[model samples]
Target: MAYRLLALDIDDTLLKSNHRLTKETKEAVEYVKNKGVYITLATGRSFISARKVAKSLKLSDPYLITHNGSFLASHVKEPVFERRIGAETVYQVVDILENYHCHFKLFHEKYVIANKTRQKAQLISRVNLQLTDPLFYPVHYVESPSHRLIDQPLSVLNIRAEFWNKRERRDALEELEESVTGIRITPGGKEELFINHESASKALALQNLASRLGIAPYEIVAVGADMRDRDMVSQAGLGVAMGDAPEEVKASADWITRSNDQSGVAYMVKEVFRKQLRIETPHQ
Candidate 1:
């Protein structure tokens, strides 16, 4: 089958373990783009953080699926589609999180507002000096995020929290799940959790974008390596899982490629996409 759109998850599915895009991977993405396959990044990262990767790919006017598909937009200021957490829910989440020993960050389209925690919860660097864009997801540290939210409510795209202790993280997740009404919490990393609106998911956003592009579920390829990516991976026509992905994630995939460290994305593009395209294309 010839796929029309290719949706890739940025963190583990696309980038390496060190968080760098390799030349081979870039070329592979270019290969698919040259073949006229629509490529999009469906990531849990904010638009700005994902934009850094998108810009490198030279994707002209890419419709990015960011914040675990909570926000879908081509430009930073304007969004094609979005599902932000309500101000009341955001306030409740913040108030509940403040009781835990975790560093939570509020995600917006342009900013990553974080809490000033003792454990140094700042995950991203100030800026990539190599890039000219000064505000590449500029992070702002607030003393009390709950206070700020109470004063000026923000319709946050998602909330990411990293815990000092795994047990605390588990407890916090349990509490939040129990307390929150309209939020979906999923494990993002080792000690991290991402909270988004109940209705927001990579699959939901991907389906929405696919409909807009006139692509059917059977004409799409989705790749990811996390629990958050389960639906998208399973529902897509060709669901690919990284070699290092969890068993459950792997079980849902139609194909499993090498690990991210081995440039799994590049491998998949060549072995799966390229090979399939060759079989479908007639000789000149």
Candidate 2:
């Protein structure tokens, strides 16, 4: 079936090795855009980070699924949907991380609050490449009235933990699930834990966007490389996994393309558009 919408993940799927778009990829996207296909970006990064890529591609003011689906905004920067973790849940999670002596960073909109620890600040700095001044609010040195100090509608409650110890993380997540109503806990990277609402994810955001555009689930194509992206790949009409993706991720994909550094996305777009053009041509 011809895909009407193409949803691509950033990180290791769309961006190249150095996290930049290649000329070939840019040209391919432009070609597809002229073909009248709706191209959208689905990513774990926030809307701010995703916008750089969208602007580079010159996408048609399409919808964007950012923060793994916690936030959805249009190319014009208009918020179409958002799912925030409850304040209570955010407080409890902060407490839990503190009790376990695990470093973490809290994201409240564009403001990222991290303890004075260099480790936590470094993590935030890496993800938010442009964060020159990360407001260092020392968690340990805070004054009295700690309860009132908790932030509101935390976007991402990130915890730094041993990712290899799956059992420990799983137990923590299971416990968190019991306490929070609209929150979902998932693994982030190799040694980190990310918490967001159950309603937040690329799949949910795409579904919402599809509904708004009057497109069906099977009319879209999704591609990604992370475990968090499993649901999205499963739901898309044609789920593609990056060549460098883990075996588990590749297994879930309908097809495996080249690595991001090899211009995999550009190749996929070229093939899809070529086939589309062939279909429009008269039979021999």
For candidate 2, the 10 contiguous residues with the lowest summed lDDT are 137-146
- Candidate 2 error regions (>4 Å): 75-77, 101-103, 120-125, 130-148, 151-181, 278-284
Indicate the TM-score of model 2.
Answer: 0.80
Clashes of 1: 0
Residue 278 lDDT in model 1?
26
For model 1, the stretches where C-alpha displacement exceeds 4 angstroms are: 120-136, 276-284
Instruction: For each candidate in turn, give its C-alpha RMSD to the true structure in angstroms.
Output: 3.7, 5.4
lDDT of 1 by residue, 1-284 (tens): 78878899987778887778899999999898877788899998888878878889888778889998899888888888899999999989889888888777788777767788656424433112212243555777899998998788898999888777789898888988888899999876658888999999999999998898888899899999898888999999999998999899999999999999999999999887775452222111
TM-score against truth, every candidate = 0.92, 0.80
Best by TM-score: 1
Candidate 1 residue pairs in backbone clash? none
| lDDT leader | 1
Candidate 2, residues 43-63, lDDT tens digits: the string is 876565677778888864567
